[model samples]
Target: MQSNAQTPDQYIEELPEDRKIAISNLRKVILENLPEGFQETMSYGMIGYVVPHSLYPSGYHCTPNLPLPFLSIASQKNFIAVYNMLVYSDPTINEWFVNEYTKYSKAKLDMGKSCIRFKKLDQIPFDLIGELASKVTVDEWINIYEAQLKR
Candidate 1:
């Protein structure tokens, strides 16, 4: 299940055994919770669940030309991570994410522009992760993305 992130794999190659497992676990959680059609792709050295342009038509992440994406996941040098731009943009959800993730993870959890990083799978709040993932449907994503692109 481990694939090197080094070159073409773009997703899970360079990761150690533990990291690979963690990433896969996280991916499963995301997939189970998300709406279908959000593709699994490699972007920015991590797993990115992309909103295809054919479906959205406006653009990925809703912009006509902005292809940044709507969600991202990764197995970094120190941790496994997840990123959801829609949630990231909202302060309410950001606080919720931090509060929820801290409950189970003893390791350091890194939060960035949109990414959430943790050292172990046990640290992630599976319930919260599912909740977040399920909330935004592909249609909602497209609308928001289009609006973002307008900006």
Candidate 2:
């Protein structure tokens, strides 16, 4: 569900007790592994990791005033969602993530284009998510985003 919380800490604090730990740990994993230059902030009501305007002034095409979003984690109604733009926009990364998911968790992959859904909190693979977060840098994400825009 979308949150009205202004900060990442606030967002986590608002979650139900059952979800608090999973979302918190996921946020921790992302913060620990996300590349330099990506800032953690509240974006689109989720805990977002974005390339700020100082790094890429053009901002997001859909919302030019906002920073360019690369990744986000949220507590959804039925599952926790991890949205990674790199996984959605880059076929190589998608293939790699899909291939590697099986090695990490016994749960079958439940995913949308960029949204990875984890229903069972205990089954979440924090290491795999961390590795995914580290797979792309801010500059690389900007380049990829620009390339897609040109298409």
Candidate 3:
């Protein structure tokens, strides 16, 4: 579900008590491990980590006015979702994440193209997510994003 909150802090504050901690922890890990050049902001009605326009003036292809989104964390209707563009855009990263997920949690990976869903909050793998956030640099993501656009 999308949020109407204007800031990341506000978004977290509005979540149900059951979800507040999990989403907060997820946000903590992402912000701590996310590489420099990526800025945290409220994006697409979720807490988003993006490559700001100062670095990539083209912004997103679909929404050119907005910054290039790299990752986002949202509390969905039934689960908390981590939307990671690196896993969606790069096959190597996707393969690595899929393989590594098994090492972190016993629960089956509930995932979409880029959205990793955690129905059981206790099973969320914070470290794996953090490492994934660190795997791609701003330059790399921009390159990968541009390449995909050309295809």
Candidate 4:
């Protein structure tokens, strides 16, 4: 769940072999499709993709000391997790992801408001994950996050 690793590379390197592979694959897909401007860092003890402070100086708003987080992938004690703040914040994206995942995945969708959990690497819906990562740019995420603050 939480990683004390200072960097994403360190986090991955510290994982057990099997977990490293799964996290690495997931990280690859995320990086390949991630919208520009989101930086990868270690946050909340996990490998996180965030809208940097330079891009959104207000920081996380909830915790201004932290960067505005967008997504994260981690190897937990029991299973791996993919956390997507965009899906949690946007009902439309959440609905679409749920529907598409159920329709296409053989693996069960174990998810919360923002975290998707799975025991195996293949259980992750790579295509859907990539799409979700690509849907929102940094500027768009800032607008959305700021709008929510106003509400």
Candidate 5:
């Protein structure tokens, strides 16, 4: 389920009290590790990391008016979710993330093509998440998105 929050702080404020700490920690990790040029905003009613128009004027391919998405954090009804587009666009990165998460985590990873679901705060490995967030540079993401357009 999406939130109605217009800003990151608002989103955090609206989250259930139990979920706030984990979300805040994850947001901190994302902000600290994310490459320069990716701005944090509320997109799709979730906390989003994006390459703003200044860096990529084309915006998102599916929705040209919006900034190009990089990653997003959401509080779902059943669990917390993290969507990383870089993992979806690049197979090698995807493979590395999956392998590393599995290797490092005690619990089985609950993940989809791009979204990683966490049933509890401890389910998330902050180091691995940070690596995934830092892996793709802005130029790399733009290149990947542009290449997808050609396909």
Candidate 6:
């Protein structure tokens, strides 16, 4: 697949203040800890980072773009979301995420196949979200994808 023309700086620059800050902070956390080779681009009108198809030809199959996203973040009309496919595969992880998120149950949750949604930066658990991001290292992602393949 061809690389996206949209650069991270350019993408963030076009965002509104609230979204920009949210995306910027999330991007900061991701870049600081995520492994290199991950690329950010505009996908479906939201900010998405993934390993290119060049690296994972079958697609971060488990991730949005296939073979890339262990983590994904997005800005929507009503919320910001972070998706972790691994959580869906692990009951323990989902349970723990729910438990951790209960501290703010009043916040809305927009869950998709693998996305978690929240309205504000404060609604997200910075430390716990970071922890969730950390859970998906390269080895873990391959293992998770391999396990999914068997299913």
Please identify model 6 stretches exceeding 4 Å from their true place: 1-5, 35-45, 51-57, 62-66, 103-110
lDDT of 6: 0.68
Please say which candidate is ahead in lDDT: 2 or 4: 2
lDDT of each: 0.68, 0.95, 0.95, 0.88, 0.89, 0.68
Error of 6 at 61 (Å): 3.9
Clashes of each: 9, 0, 0, 1, 0, 7
- Mind giving the per-residue lDDT tens digits that candidate 3 earns over 19-104? 99999999999999999999999999999999999999999999999999999999999999999998998999999999999999
How much lDDT does candidate 3 score? 0.95
Residues forming the 10-long window of minimal summed lDDT in candidate 1: 1-10
Q: Clash pairs of candidate 3?
A: none
Question: Candidate 5: how many backbone clashes?
Answer: 0
* Cα RMSD, each candidate: 4.0, 0.7, 0.6, 1.2, 0.9, 4.1
lDDT of 6 by residue, 28-62 (tens): 88777776666666654456666577766667544
Please state the error at residue 16 of candidate 3 in Å: 0.9
- Maximum-lDDT candidate: 3
Candidate 2: list runs displaced more than 4 Å. Answer: none
lDDT of 5 by residue, 1-151 (tens): 8888888999999888878888998999999999998999999989999999999998997899999999999999998999999888888898899889877688888989889999977778977888889997899889988887788
Number of residue pairs clashing in candidate 3, backbone atoms closer than 3 angstroms, sequence gap of 3 or more or interchain: 0
Model 2, residue 123: C-alpha shift (Å)? 1.3
Off by over 4 Å in 1: 1-10, 60-68, 102-109, 149-151
Candidate 2 has which clashing residue pairs, if any? none
- Arranged by TM-score, best first: 3, 2, 5, 4, 6, 1
Per-residue lDDT tens digits of candidate 4, residues 1-119? 58788888889999999888888888898999998999999889998999998888889977998999999988888888899998888888889898989865888789999999988
